[model samples]
Target: MARGKEQPARRGGGGRAIGRVIPWAVIGLWVAAVAVLAPFAAGLDKVKSDKVVDYLPSGAESTTVAALEEKLPGGGVNDFVVVYYRAAGITADDRTTAERHLAVLDRKYPGPPTDSAPPSIPAGENGPHTVGADGDKTTGSSSRVQDSRDGKALLFAHSVGTASGEPSAYLPALRKLLEDRPAGLEAKVTGPGAIEGDIDAVFDGIDAKLMITTVIVVTVLLILIYRSPVLWLLPLLAVGCAALISMAAVHLLAKNFGVVVNEQSAAVLVILVFGVGTDYALLIVARYREVLQTEADTNRAMSVALRSAGPAIIASAGTVAAGLLCLLAADLNSTSGLGPVGAVGVACALIAMLTLFPALLLVLGRWVFWPKVPKVLPAGVTGAVAGQARWDRLGAWIDRRKGLAAFGSVVFLGAVALGLLGGPGSLRSQDQFVKTPESVSGFTLVTRHFPHIGGQPITVIAPTAKKDAVLEAAEAVKGVSQVVPGRSGAEYAEITVFPKDAPDSPAERRTLKALRAAVDKVEPAAAVGGPSAQNLDTATTSARDEKIVIPLVLVVITLILGALLRAVAAPVVLILTVVVSFAAAIGASTLVFEHIFGFKGIDPGLPLLGFLFLVALGVDYNIFLMHRAREESLLHGTRRGILGSLSATGGVITSAGVVLAATFAVLATLPLVPMAELGFLVAFGVLLDTLLVRSILVPAVGLRLGSRLWWPSALGRHTDPEDADGQASVPIGRERALRN
Candidate 1:
């Protein structure tokens, strides 16, 4: 580096004053913003809903039933089935104990008991029917106690009005009523309502847990990456600021615009902001350090860093936000709600990192990098160190054996993809939790003692005039064991059908379809809905959403890359690598779920969510690499530029990737199966993209294309030696000239 190449250590009086004042001004603005928004952020949880109806597809029959249920005289109902059992078989004493528990429930949780409440078994049926606490037929009451033929279990089925609130609010007290059961009888509450209660309980303190854990994980990793106890705080602080802004923004959207924010989306929002905000910090810091080696003025160094690295950072954020926003197209409420929530988070992160983060860095100055603070170097001396030598050599080798590198990378990704041999299986509600709750245990017990009767009811709402035809059609379904008439409303009537198979069983699904078809023919206005039907609709709707959203996300990202890189070929190559990496990640995750974690099956929506994350976040590293490569290629030839860019960015990009992966891996701490599975897949996919896809395959492809990699761009053609001559003395890594 020559002296002429160095930027002046001091600037004009006006420039210096403005530069000094700008940082403080930016800091003040952020403080005010945080002070104003913190309250709303704290209120974010108030708007979140985790109800089953909230997550189901908007137009699904189950969703419609849930909406219509609210319109019935006593429509909003929570149904519970309490199971009492003794392995030795229910003795006469056990029956008495069960009846006492039923009496307690009836007295404590008794609803107004409208026609819309779940019906009791008809008299003289083959199976056991519910009897009142005094052993008489319980008519027009919400509680019913039935015994199993095996003489080992007793089931007390009941309904309560949902007017109080979600089942979670009152179910705990109801379950507590059963805690004093006789020692010989094992009592547990299980049913659709109880299962939902358990789920809500799992997410009770999830945000706090995820926030504390994520902050700790990111803090530790940042400390290690920066190697300075004090230095790591800056990025973390900036990310916290971003988190507050995002939380507030999301809360407003959810409160005012009817955006769906569930526990899962809220949890994920935290991880995304932290992971992505920290990533932007890493890239900016690396560029700032690079600029500081030549420009002594902190302001000038920051300006140069932002000018050079800011486009990639913006593009990275845009790509991720755009990809997430594509989720708006999903039919599932939870899935669609996540789109804007995540996009807002990413946008907030971008705003904070690009604005507040840089200002904080400038205010702190070189001390921010204290232990190994970058120093100004002589004009002809570069910042390249021995650690970067490996990347230069690797780049040269990749260039020399481009074909082999590409082939090996493809083969490796494909091999990992072999885990998809057995398709990602469908997850059942019972398996949705990593640890079994009492609801699951109770459901299992009920199924064991009453295998012939479905433990869950399939609800059918039909026009009052066609109730008889719908009932006959529902009973005609192959897997249906009984069709019980339910309360009649002004326009519609309820018909409860019991399937012979379990709710999650294949036979139940078949029966659901057949029942829907049969009823549709008899009464077009009739809708088949219930816990089982909800599961079926969610799976099918999620599959449909994947087809629509994934392709849109791909196009959105490619266009972002094309505009940022200003090149077609490079963007296409990067997109391809990201897509392949996504597939491999999904494949590997499927195997891990089935074998390592022992998850029963994958969530139907996991693939779409995983694809969005892997592609958007995975392409982030390539944007940093290729953007730098494009800048360098204009000066040096494409071969040397690619090598130099690789050497320069390889360290920072890998660090960013590790940070992201670690943040997402935090998701595994959650008890929900879907969150854990998603966290693992994204984490694994990120590492794959950084370590192999970006590091080797992408660079190799770029090197093979040479200057032509920037098709349609001026840099794609011959570079003007005179233009290159102005910076011929621009210092680069000594090994960057490695033979190709």
Candidate 2:
């Protein structure tokens, strides 16, 4: 009989163990495959090599004068103009140097205007058009400050790219090109691009800051968790490898698949690795310890823990991955890129925790609890705090009175939530990037010197082939104090008008409505497309998504919680808790925006962003609690189960929260408005989830519902252990509880 049982047990152990680890592999492989495509990682390390070299004004002046009339676009339509004013005359040498620098940069630029206009006389609408400032003070020249008295000054500026791309990367090269000039000349490339370029410069310091913080925080947490430098070794190794490979994959994918990582996504990746990876390892290790107390044999305990805890971890990872995927609905490309990349990181965390972690456990399990001698303790206390009498006493004290634990969670979350009143807005604008020095300088320079440079002039285009109705459509608008019959070409007609600003300001909205109404009357293939048109498109896009994404993510998150818990009520309660927390997070972020940022309205996109992050991370702790509660309840009973689960995983969750919170908090240091808001919002949300939702609401809900919480009809039901479905099928605390 013994031989027969032993043979079957060995076969079952080998087969079942392999089966249990499938979710880990599947989740891991799927993500790794998607992330390996970044092409822009390093640029041969030369910060200022081969930038723009020359930009010269040709004196073929009168010869090309007709070309200028053909494309006589106003100041706003003109690209950037660089101003290099000297105290003396600008000779061929000065012109030669500035022109060469500008030319080098100009060569790399994808030529102005994405449309098909022949590259004729690149100066027509696109080139080194020179102009004097409003006045040359000494000469009292009417053409202004752009020109120096002795002609020693040179001004250089051009539209780098649609005024859409950030300038930091390009600005440095421009600055260096000027700095490397044959001396005595000052060149400042003041444009939207230049300003953005400077802000990007500040970001260079971030990678170093993140590296130090990760090392310190991880080292400290490891020391506290394992108490043995030896045991902390494997988990640290796992996180490092996972983070490195995950990042490499994101960059690689970005390089190849066209998914570019913005500053926000790049910053979030480090924190994601530490927090998510650490959470997975902690769950597996805690379960492994529980298995040890009863199994005695280390191998059996290791196999046993993997078979049980691995699925929960994988399911937790799925929720995170799915939450990130919802970003595809966002209008911003920066946010859209985050959706898939964050999922990839979660996948990496799952893999490292499941495979490499198990192998490490096999080698290091014996020595993991060293110095303290591996003595078994009652259920729920990790060896990390095993020897501390005061902690044990406190743990016991909490076990004795659970009500206080419940109340404290309510008080803390409710208070932090009070800030919710400040959140506002419906759209985050590109203008937010203007808060930087480069942007401010560019804005001031343009506003002061180029009065006609504020807006993208509205252009109505109809085929050169259509004249009657098209021209009629153009003539029907009410705001047109004047309409110039059509200028640019047979193919393009330019209508100049002084229409009121509608949709943005109330009075303007009225003017726009009338203009739109008149346009409708003419109905000439008319679809709006300039700055106002883009805003209308953006508002439409945001409104449509608002009606959709959040509710959908919430539903998906709820179903995920239910399925992960394997209980009907548990998922429902967890969903509700997460929803309430999400509301509070949004409300709090709103308050931060209104009172602190002093912005008018919330960015239309901020709500979805806050909602998704809160739901995802908040539910992460929920998974920890439910899995812990079920394990502890089966081993002990309902009341003790809640206490035991809290004690075992609570500390780790809180530590993960601290690291995540701190990393996101770093975003506030950026020069851009959106980044500052995003940083604080995400950091504060994580803190609320870690401190309140996981530790308090979950335990309190568990306690309040008691056995009823796991109903419909049974969940991890512990009793006679002979049944195939019995919860205590292999519980360590079962024998002791039976004896008691």
Candidate 3:
């Protein structure tokens, strides 16, 4: 087959050099990057930060409240009704006890607001009131709480806003006050903050849990790959610097540009830098190990490593960064900003892989593999079969059954592909985390007590040219079940339309259609907003975003891949493969959610995110594969070149896939269903990339391409043993050592 030693492969040079020298330099740069926004990350959310209170739930969804709702009061629960109590239970003495208790608890005022100005209280009177013209009162909180039916049970009622807003700051103090109560009557606080506080308490060790897991996984993987503690420190140093720089960059952008970044996302960013960066580091370090095994000259080996693996790493980085850019398509600002932060971080990791990592490798010299001397391969380095004694048998087998290998690979991928029949989750059954705390708790309570609980409310925002009276007029519109006053005085009222089902339910669609007709009947002037309106906005935004962002990301990725590979067809083919892989990933995610997780379909935005992530990272694997294939092609001609490249590159990509997929799979542990489903989908996608796309399809395609695979090139005709194209063909540094 003239397929002698699979193409002359390039070995390690840059990974070790950069591993040794650049981390120190990167330290300075990272600190400077941190200084770029140390003021911000340190204090971006310091002043009444919404991020601080946002996810905290009020007592409504607290476990205790849920337990109680399951017990008494006939049936329904008032989401998180704070029972205000002033009762003269059976006698004046009992009543005074109740009043004294309420005063001690300071239960009358509905808490203070951040502005120090009181929040406009809900229009309803606090429960039922007993009043005479003389302004007499024996009522309110007592009726709701203390005067239990048949006088056997007495409970008081009060009200509080959601924990996510200004109300949350002081909600804790209020709860503490209630807990410190007198005997006979228990002051039980149940609100949104209470629920969140409970979750926090229940999952107190979550951060520690995640950290321990990550460290254990990473340590094991690093030990396996680098085989040295020294090598471990190198990747950490590079990635730590990248993380600091990325965070600083994010803080700076948010501060200067007013781009809102949710605090919850900060955690996601930290994990991403470590996880993805580690994978990239593995690729570079492994290449260095390969290079060190061959050439005696440390510098030359390092250069060869860089020249050969550098393009692949750079290409991978570019693809990952560009894919993250696709996240900008998310209509929600909080989710959208995640894309760029990740993209920028990945970009930094790539640059460090090439520059700083190479510098460190140069400094470390042989010490990088300290504790174990570098293995020297003296057999003219016969591509895949030379020093990889580990996988000789497997390589030989693939060498023996090329057709069966290709067919089995394609068929296996197709089986996974069929899983794509299911679509991503539907908004109707969005994972539970998105439910309004009140809706969730109240639904539970009412379902237990009342045989019939009404459906979800479709909130209507009454828009106005003039702020004052528009809301009043809006409340009077037909088909509206109830009018809840909005924060804006009369300009924007929150009209609740209770449909037969929730907003995403088909029954709600009928309500929406009726509501639209009702709005149409209103004077031509008054503007309105409802779930239908929001849905329309979402659909339009989604469509427009797909049109613009998908193409933009694809174009950017193509350019970056082409530039890195120095080959047009390679990037184009890889991109196509990524696109197909992405579709299959999304399809698989949808099927999982619908069939296994019990969701109806995938999130509308899931495809875009999957496309962005898998495609971009998928490109990295592709580049890594082709670059290895191209290197092999140089020495082994076409046939052996393909075999050698596949064997050598397969292990690294597979390792990366396993590690990455495992890390993402941990997201399934999150209580939120979207995160769980997303985690599974991505984990599966990465697995598919490593097992099917990278190891199977990519090589099959490469083998089929033969010489045309590296076309329009000066090196195209130079693979004959007579022609010498040194990997470190041109020295790339200020000193001989740096030149490699």
Winner by lDDT: 1
Tens digits of per-residue lDDT for model 1, 1-740 = 12364455576899899999999999999999999999999999999987777789998998988877766667577778888989888887777777788777767776435444444533223344555543233323433656676778877777777765788888889878887867867999888888888899999888888999999999998898889867899999999999999999999999999988989899999999999999999999988888888888999889888888898998999999999999999999989989999999999999999999999999999988888989999867887742698898898799778889989999989988888888547998877998999999998998887675664788898988898988988888898877877667888887788887877678889989999999999988889898889999999999999999999998999999989877788889899989889888888888889888899988888999999999999988999999888777755667777888999999889999999999999998788898999999999999999999999999888877776678766566443222322223223342133211
lDDT of 3 by residue, 484-570 (tens): 332232232223333434445555555555655555455333333332334433444545556767887898888887676556767
Clash tally, candidates in order: 3, 69, 62
TM-score for candidate 2, please give it.
0.68
Write model 2 residue lDDT over 230-266, tens digit each, in one string: 7777777777667766776676676567665655576
Error of 1 at 145 (Å): 2.1
Q: What TM-score does each of the candidates earn?
A: 0.93, 0.68, 0.71
Rank all candidate structures by their lDDT, best first, as comma-separated numbers: 1, 2, 3
Where is model 3 more than 4 Å wrong at Cα? 1-213, 375-411, 420-442, 450-453, 463-480, 484-500, 513-517, 520-548, 566-568, 591-604, 634-636, 708-740
Quantify how close model 1 is to the true structure by its C-alpha RMSD in Å: 4.4
Between candidates 1 and 2, the one scoring higher on TM-score is 1
The window of 10 residues in a row where model 1 has the poorest summed lDDT is: 731-740
